[model samples]
Target: MAKSKNFLLLISLLAFFPLCFSSKTIGGYLYPQFYDHSCPKAQEIVKSIVAKAVAKEARMAASLLRLHFHDCFVKGCDASVLLDGSGSIITEKISNPNRNSARGFEVLDEIKDALEKECPHTVSCADILTLAARHSTVLTGGPSWEVPLGRRDSRGASLSGSNNDIPAPNNTFETILTKFKRQGLNIVDLVALSGSHTIGNARCTSFRQRLYNQTGNGRPDYTIDQSFAAQLRRRCPRSGGDQNLFFLDFVSPTKFDNSYFKNLLAYKGLLNSDQVLLTKNQQAMELVKQYAENQELFFVQFAKSMIKMGNISPLTGSRGEIRKNCRKINS
Candidate 1:
């Protein structure tokens, strides 16, 4: 009898472990076990699809991760970024920050489809996006954390909010920090979240100004190494190749690591938004140096900051609906 009681107690404790990381929102709590009963295989389905996608195209990991960031920044991870324009809806996909960029939608659709078939109207697209981001990070050799689930998809997309809210590559450090602050993130979150650049690519157009005319002075930005600038200019050029791709972290570009911070220290950061983390603010510079020196510390903070960012203004309880199609609200 004693042995049986002890075994049951241990099982109960194990089952309750995920609830420890639950995040509280205005409507209700979001716990990791949100679908343990309703959709027992929800996370497994998402992870499998994300793994297949990332295995096929390593860049897909970063693109999926970026989708979560872009989604949360605009409307709090409500899948607003996934919506297409129809009637009253205006797609955020065509916004300045996302147009010609922001990929991995088909991968998301694949995950959502599998999820819907497994459990109809049970898992939310918002939750799928959140899980995909976490899976993508882990797939690219980054840390993982328990993502609180139970989020719902928004009924509409925000084009204006998408354009103005998402940080632009050319924005000054202050502007970027302010944008993050508006999302309830802080300086530490800014530096840590920016570390996501460790595993992504940037367009030539995103940083051409720094290579050719950083301040419209018709001269290269001296902040960048002359040799590196010359190499970038060859591909980026003064006129065309706007869509040319460059690794955000030239060293270990496909791996999620602190090399991005080290690149910033060496002035090799691919985007102006990236280099400014070190040059434009003393505090952010210190963070860059710390992360460059300590990969473990960067990983720990990256996981925490990601969870914090994921918790921004989620729709819970009776707030939002679980959309049948990720691209449109339920009719």
Candidate 2:
């Protein structure tokens, strides 16, 4: 009888203690159990769809991961990135960082359709993106964490925020750090979150400036590995092939691991922003070395930073609506 009473007290503590579960609120409460009773199969459905998509195309995992990042950085993980231009909304898909990039919207539509069939407006598109991102990491050989759900869909999209807020591949280290800080992320979060590049692809256009004229000079950036630069140039060229695909990490590109940090130590990081983590600041450089030396540390920090990033200014309580369709606002 005494043990039963203690168990009930422990349960009560968990029910009230947000930090114990890492479900602290910013603008509103978002907890992992938000849909446990309402839509018990919500997470299962997201994982199954994300796994199928990733199995179909290994790159799909990376694309879905990026979708969550792009969404959160702009209007706080509200699924505003999913909105198509209609009425007063301006589409973010055409933004510089997203144009010809940011694939996997059709995959999201399929997930939403499945959820609607099962639960019918019980889950938010924002939650779907967040859950899909965590699943993507796991499917791609990365760590998993409990996603705090209950985020809502935005009624409008931000084209300017998408363009200005998302850091470019060639952005200076300070510029990238500044952009992350604007989103309430710190230096550690910036370095850890940037590790998402471990499993993605980048366009030739995104890093071409370094290959040809890094500082308006005729030579390639000396910071890059010579043989690697030659290989990149064979496909990238000086002009054209802007849409050509290149792995962000040449070694283990599709697997989320410490290879990205190792590539930086070797001066083979695919993007200027990547290498700058080593060159630009002493602290970030130490972080790169630490992650390169310890995959477990990177995984832990990456999960924590992802949770922090997902918590940015969420619309909860009564602010936004859970759209029946992810792409349009409800009338």
Candidate 3:
């Protein structure tokens, strides 16, 4: 009778509860979701900031812009990625301090000078990072994901909070899928936006797996292609490795085109997460083909993916503060 009663209770609980309420698994990895009710005006002000930054440091605007997008995409536009990953690390997972690039701070200062002049404290540097991310995509010759504005700055950046938030770059397809689904994004978006990897730079420490892993020796059921495999292995070799290897185009590293996907199709994608696109699903395979052949297809999907990615871990409705500098929160 007790067993029967317990079974009934278990069923009742499962039936009555919402799935998300079941656990914080999805959330512990996403950025806060803040509603940007005031995104348009904020976007315009941000656009002006980009223009100013471009006027001063034309060569670097695209990179700074990419920085913000990268942060938002990884853990929503929470600006947490702008910090020390908020200390978001998975068990046995390596931490990537991509945001810690001094290059990011260098461009951020230029943007601060511009925003302070036009909007002053009226605009938060957090919003500036979000807007700058969108503009940077456009500047990079990719589609602009429409950014909703007015995300107030986070009051406290818990390196602890961040540590549990961002996804691991070296994760498996299942791991990446679970992480993305938590943020309301799906596998298709994951594979598509990951094509952005085609143009970015990374340290071998981030992607040494595909290089040193056993399957990459060119076996069936191996994650990626051999030529691409050999290339990454060469960079982060069992022998002494070189750090300047770009994950983007072996042909044209800086151009934001389909080469990343093209490389993945060839098994040349730099990261293990990247090679998973080919093995993740037949649908992802189709996307790789479409994106490689049709630039517009890649653009449209990338824009949608960016918007979805940004919505993760947001700071909606008085959740966070608007800081004077993006690097640090306002007291």
Candidate 4:
């Protein structure tokens, strides 16, 4: 009679929370419903904070989206990018690609604080990043997709991975492709992901080399439209103002769209890495043209590629800990 009562209780609980109890698994794969029961409001909390942050600063959406990319590239979206230097753990923030480029840490902290009040340590910081990126994209009129959860925070960071794995704005097309391949991504993924440039700003220092002495011949890169080059020069210059900001996509800087690929076609792409898709390789150029010509196609592939990128070597099944503070590993 006692066994029958216990079995009845279990069935009633499962009936009331069908998704919550069954979503989290022990294996490596993640699911969108991982936090359905564990923290039912996890996704909502992240999206609300991201939306509020983006509303305060239109560029916050892009910055938050880029944060996920940066985190994934180094140490597999384990929130390694969030860790500050402590003991043996060297922070990735000071690395080359992240030195002056990465932003949106404060916004993440705000989200983390809110989540802690609601669900405590049930949600992981890495999952918050992935969810924030998706919400940021949607807030900026980009495609929305289900972000798989279950990623845990890393106990240590990789400064070397940040420097070597994330491609620089001036890297050669072959080098950039090699970096993506290292992440198990292909050319299509690379081109689709680069479309993220459609919505952000780039520092003058990141692309100043293309405006002057691109090939060490003391001449500007001929591939860049001369008028655009002149505009960039007025702000970038040769010596000072290395930190001057330029819109990556001047047409719709805050909107997510195919104008970046179109800019590449017009030789007005802000980064050498952006323009090389057109000039350096046939396959890459074809992909760029397709995306530029078809916004729906680009959006579809971008959503798919984002899921692929987010799935790269995530920590699951007790591999890592849920960080209490994003910037510091648990003591």
| Per-candidate TM-score against the hidden true structure | 0.92, 0.92, 0.72, 0.91
- The local lDDT score (0 to 100) that residue 23 gets in candidate 2 is 46
Candidate 3: tens digits of C-alpha lDDT, residues 228-262: 66756655776555454454457556566677777
Q: Which structure is stronger by TM-score: 1 or 4?
A: 1
Candidate closest to the true structure, highest lDDT? 1
Query: Candidate 4: misplaced stretches above 4 Å?
Result: 1-26, 217-219
Cα lDDT tens digits, model 1, 277-309, are 988899999999999999877877787777778
How far is each candidate from the true structure, as Cα RMSD in Å?
5.6, 5.4, 11.9, 8.9
Per-residue accuracy of model 4 over 39-141 as CA lDDT, tens digit each: 9999999998899999999999989888899999997989999888888888899999999878999999999999999988889899999999989888988
* Cα lDDT listed for each candidate: 0.88, 0.87, 0.58, 0.87
Clashing pairs for predicted structure model 4, backbone only: none
lDDT of predicted model 4:
0.87
